[model samples]
Target chain A: MNEIMSILSYTFFQRALLCGIAISFSAALIGVILTLKNYSMIGHGLGEVGFAAIALALALNLPTYAVSIPIVIIAAIAIMIISQKKGEGADLIIALVASGALALGVIITAFTSGFGTDAYNYMFGSILTIGSADVILSIALTVISVGTYAFFYNRLFLVTFDESYAKARGIRVTLYQFLIALITALVVVIGMRMMGTLLISSLIIFPAIIAKRHTNSFKGMVFTSVFVSIACFIIGMFSAYFLNLPTGAGIVLIYMILSALSLATTKLLKL
Target chain B: MSLLEIKKLNVSYSNHYALEDIDLKIDEGEYVCLVGENGSGKSTLVKTIVGLKKQDSGTINLNIELGKVSYLAQFNLKDLNFPATAKEIIMTGTQKHGKLPFYSKKDKEVYKRVIEQLHIEDLQNRRIGDLSGGQKQRVLIARALISEPELLILDEPTAGLDYNITQEFYKILKQLNKENKLTIIMATHDIEELANDKPRIVYLSKKVVYDGNYDGWKGYEK
Candidate 1:
């Protein structure tokens, strides 16, 4: 208990903890919406885009956040436009765009910055060096994301269920869709710092899947996902501290394992 | 004057014309049944009328505006696994024009009335995914009624149901049509089933083959 308190009292550890919680809360909320809308793959693409933009910033020695904002938003808009075209095939487009962007980022890094140990850490995630600025950004983005969701809850629900029905009833399906995509891009941007590019999408998908297995209503699913995500973050971070494992990977693995167990529990109880 | 007009409408899918130069006009309160065989453009015409697919070159003028339509698309058209209750699903019909984040009491009352009218009050709490096929169709119909739409469009409203349940649904539809004087346009393949009622009938197979009395159209099909 004394050791745990000592770790918690450190400023860097406190910032890392706050950043992790904020990322988890926002990702789980948006993730439930994405899972319900059947757009889970978009998160994968957006996270990679944000990751690549950061890599480009690092390689060019520019402010990473400055270069990242426009690139991630553009990527989100481009994916939305591509998905709109008939036969564009969302899964293939996202996969191709993400892998291609990530590859370009790596090639640039190799040429400009040389192979470095920190690059691999960034690829996975390192909570050890997360600053207070990162924590504040995460909190601000999470608040904005969750606030938007609260205000547009019903509109989003209607649009996700039936686009034509929503349109007929005079709901702006396109507007809601764009709003959702925009928030998702923001979440991906902030989440990349805590979960890294590779495991970040899992932060958006796993808890939502667990929540879905237990609940039958949209509200129930969202709240359950948020709760599970927060719990996983705390447990995973503490366990990683003691086990000398990677913090982000530990959190992701904890989420995945608990999600599996939740699924099993729901089945056992026939929920 | 017609309440809705479709003049020289043409709908194509990747170079194949699904509906060709089709002209249609429906007056207010007319119960029109669109009949045809499979791949005969009946579904395409219905879809075009509902604005799901835009016509390549045509004009669709509606006196009641497009927002007033309540469409019950083909069963296969909806994603059944969607996470919502039957009542919640039905409530979406009213929420489009509703005030944000809350449903009005009048809207709630209308929903209640529709559920009672369609005998689906028991299924209000059930997930739409959990309902049987016939029950799902009934809930969809309830949803269409909740909005008190000026025009109700149904695309195969009775697909994947036993004969008794289909007839029961139409009987309920008939009651609502008479009580509310709601305009209805339905497309169905079961010509033998709806042959008795003399609703306006439009037969289309990529073109307007016939448009006149319903009873006379049945002879052409035979």
Candidate 2:
């Protein structure tokens, strides 16, 4: 207990906790929509695109987010366009793009000097290095994401469930789809700093699936996903601090365990 | 003026014509049934009317604005697993009213009225996935009616329903058309059962083979 308190006393740990919680909340909300649409893999694909952008930024000694955000957004739009075409599934397009981005990132890292350590930290995550600026950015992005969701909740729900019906109702299905993709891309870019490129998609997928096992309504699933994600982040952060484990992997493990518990409980209760 | 008008409309898939040179007109408060075999362009015509598909070369003139058309797509159980209550699903129909984040009192009243009208009050709070097929169809119809649309377009709504449920579903549609004077355009393959409703039939086999009452359709089919 004393050791946990001592870890919390550090400013970096405080920032990490705040950032993780905020990002998790936003990711889970986006995850519910994406997962229900069967576009969950887009999160992972965008993370890889962000990873590539981050590597390019590192090679150029530029700001990480400033470079990654715009590129990831473009990649997201490209994915949307490619997926919109007939005879091609979005998952297949996302897989192609994700593999391409991962390869590009690896190639960039191989050439960039002194990037090995930063790359390793980015991939595995080091919450100990989280700064105040990252916390502020995470909070700001979270507000944008959550606020956008709240404001357009009805439209998003309509588009996600039955886009054809939404279109006939004059809901501008394409515009809302683009908006979701943009928001998800931003969330992926911000999340990569704390959760790492390889593991960030877990933050966007696990909570929603876990909540889905227990809830029978969209609102219930969304609310429960946010709650579970925030709780998991907090507990996972504490465990990472006390157990001297990697933050991203530790949090993902916690989510896996909770997901298993949720699955079993739901089946047992027949909910 | 006709509530809906389609002239010289052509739709194709990979250069194979699905609907060719289709010309049709529907006036207000008309309960029109479009009947055809599979791949006979019944679905395509309705889809084009609702703006789901684009016409290759023609014009579709709707007297009412596009927003006033409510559509219930063909029943696909893929989205039945979506986590939404019947009430929530119905409430989304009010999205066309304004830009408010929440439904207005009038919107809520409409929702309530539709729920009552559809006799789905008991199922309002129930999850859509939990409802029986007939019950889900009622909820979807309620969703369509909540918008107070001038025209309601449904595509094979009773495709999977049993005979009793299908009859009940058609009865509700007939009531809406007669009592409320709601315009309806439905596409279905069950011409024999639907013929009893006395709806004006538009028979199509890639093109309109008959456009008249059921007796005329029977004569034309023979």
Looking at candidate 2, what is the lDDT of residue A102?
Answer: 91
What is the RMSD, in Å, between candidate 2 and the native fold over all Cα? 1.7
Tell me how far the alpha carbon of residue A43 in candidate 1 is from the true structure, in angstroms, after superposition: 2.6
Candidate 1 residue spans exceeding 4 A from truth: A84-88, A167-170, B77-81, B95-100
Q: Cα deviation of A132 in candidate 2 (Å)? A: 2.7
Q: For residues B112-198, could you state the per-residue lDDT of candidate 2 as single tens digits?
A: 999999999999888888899899899999989887888999888888889999999999999999999999999998788876688
Best by TM-score: 2
* TM-scores for candidates 1 onward, in order: 0.93, 0.96
DockQ of each: 0.41, 0.58
Model 1: how many Å of interface RMSD? 2.6
Give the lowest summed-lDDT range of ten residues in model 2 chain A.
Answer: A113-122
Best by DockQ: 2
